[model samples]
Target: MALRPNPTLRQRRVGTELRRMREQAGLGGNQLARELGIHAAQVTQMETGKSGISVERLRTIAAACLCGNQPLIDALADMVSERGKGWWEKYRGTLSTDFLEIAELEANAHSISTWATTYVPGLQQTEDYAAAMFSRFTPSPPSHDLDARTSFRMQRKEAVRHGKTPYASFIHEAALRMQFGGPRVLADQLNHLVDDSLAGRISVRVVPFDLDTFPGGGENIMFIEGPVPELATLQMDTAMGSMYFDAQPSLTRHRDVFARLNSVALSEPESREFIRSIEYEMRGKYA
Candidate 1:
């Protein structure tokens, strides 16, 4: 098969874990190839996700490297296993890579948790709110592109919901107050949020403005849990680009930060009531 020029996040993850395993066992790429009877360059390609690896070869490498973590190995194998194409593939060339990658990540995630200071998380946004968001793009996307993106986002939300992956989120009160698409639109969005929270569709907690300190700045932080701790990923949307973090230290630190946010945020019942209160405020002020 021809090598993939732009491998999906899952494919790259398979290679990343393999590289980590090799390093842990103190074997270089060339050394591992010598032990596995493959060319040195082939080993590098496989490790970097440019080339695919079969399940049998993956197991062989694990055995050769003395990797005793059975669960991690199985997770890696599953990542590489042949599977049906995702619904997002249709939009592969149409939408940007970040959109497809995020959908793929959430579609496969065991669970997802997100934190946002000034905007609602995409998975939880209403259709109108989503469209309004796209309208704010730097140069303002053409109508066709905007429609395509909005449609893709709605499909993504449905896919994750159909998959029934556990979802939870923390939204600062400032985001709840920030008006997007005007007061009526934001009010409708908040109402939808309240309904979802009350219906147990998602666990959303609000970080009130009165807090002494709100860590992690104002950026969006999403933590996608994998089958195992080692596969967990931390993602952030930056001005430069989307940044994905999987290093042990990075994962550990972000996990801790989320824990702190969770603790500081309101409980489920309290959060629901709080969101409802905000919705009522919006309606009273602008309805």
Candidate 2:
């Protein structure tokens, strides 16, 4: 079968697991391919998530690799059999693949933690706020493009709100206070935040500007916890795209960073109060 070229995270994940199993068994790609009577390039493609593997083929490879663990085999089989259009497919021609990949990661993440220093995190952004933020870029986006982006964002937010996943975010006070879409929009967004907080699907905290410092102080970051423990932590960078790190030492460092940020952020109740206070200030402008 021809390779899919651009595979979804689900597909890539399955491929990653297969590769890990092969490595664990001390078998090289060429050796595995030779054993399976397939070209080495095909093995490489499957391992890299550029192609899909069938259940029977996967089982054969698993057995040859000595991956007798039934649970692991079952998981691989399940991932291969699982078929559906990813949320990102809709925006394929409109947005970059990198953007779609980020959306997919957010959708599939078991838990997500983000620290926003400049703007409201996309998942938490209100439509008007998103429109205003996008409007500020140089050259200015066309009306249709801006609307499409906004629609895409709203759809993503719904996925998070309705899905079984959990989301937590630390917003810098500056971000919450930014007058995007003017005072009316800002107030509505803050009010929406207040309401969403009450929903229990999301946890919001404010990182005070006075807080001493941290490595991520100036950077916007999103850390997503994946379903599998080994795949758990992903750090997203706008410029660098998504990076997955499973090493204990690296995970420990990022976790510590989050803990420090959490410590400095206003408690959830305090955050709501802070937001309410800001809303009050904006009301005068809108009124």
Candidate 3:
């Protein structure tokens, strides 16, 4: 196949994993190229995700790198064989690459866990709530694009809903009370959460503002559990844009942080009641 000028996040990640294995084996790209009877530049292209590698070639490279982990090897093989377009591909030019990449990651994840300090997790947000939040983006997005953004988010929720992907959200109480859109919209959103939690596809937990302390400085996180532990991914948003981490150490730290946050959050039933109280308060105020 011809080389790709722009690779998707998943493609880049597959190449990155291969590079890691090669580095661990203490073999240079040039040396591996010699072993595989491919030009040195071709190896660089594969490592950078500019060129696609066949499933057979991926296995050969893994063996050459002295990697013995079957699961990891199988995962990479799957990446090599992944073909065709995903639903997110339709929005490639219409939306930012970051948005498309996020949807792709969530779609492929085995399960997802999130920690939200100021906003409801995207996969659980109602349409009006999301539109309100997006409208407040720094400098504000063009008014014409607001509908597209909201629809994209609503589609993202399907990632968890369809697969029964075991989504767990740890949201701070402040997020529940932020009143995005308005009191009525926020109330609707809170009520929606209660309904979702009852449906058993999602689990919601709240960390009350009264907590003396919180984990990770209440930073936002979206940890995507892959088919295997070694393939887990952590996504963090920054002032500039979203950053993704798949390295072992980064994944380990995020997993630990999520665990601590989960420990301090309210139980499912308790969280439902907490959200219900907030909904009642909002209804009284908004009515």
TM-score, candidate number 3: 0.96
User: In candidate 2, which residue pairs get closer than 3 Å at backbone N, Cα or C atoms, i.e. clash?
Assistant: none
Using lDDT, give the best candidate's number.
Answer: 3
Each prediction's RMSD over C-alphas, in Å, is: 1.3, 2.9, 1.3
- Model 2 alpha-carbon miss at residue 52, Å: 0.9
lDDT winner between 2 and 3, please give it. 3
lDDT of 1 by residue, 1-287 (tens): 68989988889889999999999999988889999998999888888899999999999999878899999999888888957888899998888898888888898899999998878888888899999988987999999899999999899877766678898889999888877897788889998888778878688898999888796757888999999999999889777767898999988888888889888998988877887887788788775
List model 3 lDDT by residue over 135-163, tens digit each.
Answer: 98888888768888889999998666877
> What does the lDDT read for residue 116 in candidate 3?
87
> Would you list the C-alpha lDDT of every candidate in the order shown?
0.87, 0.81, 0.88
Model 1 scores a TM of 0.96
RMSD of candidate 3 to the true fold? 1.3
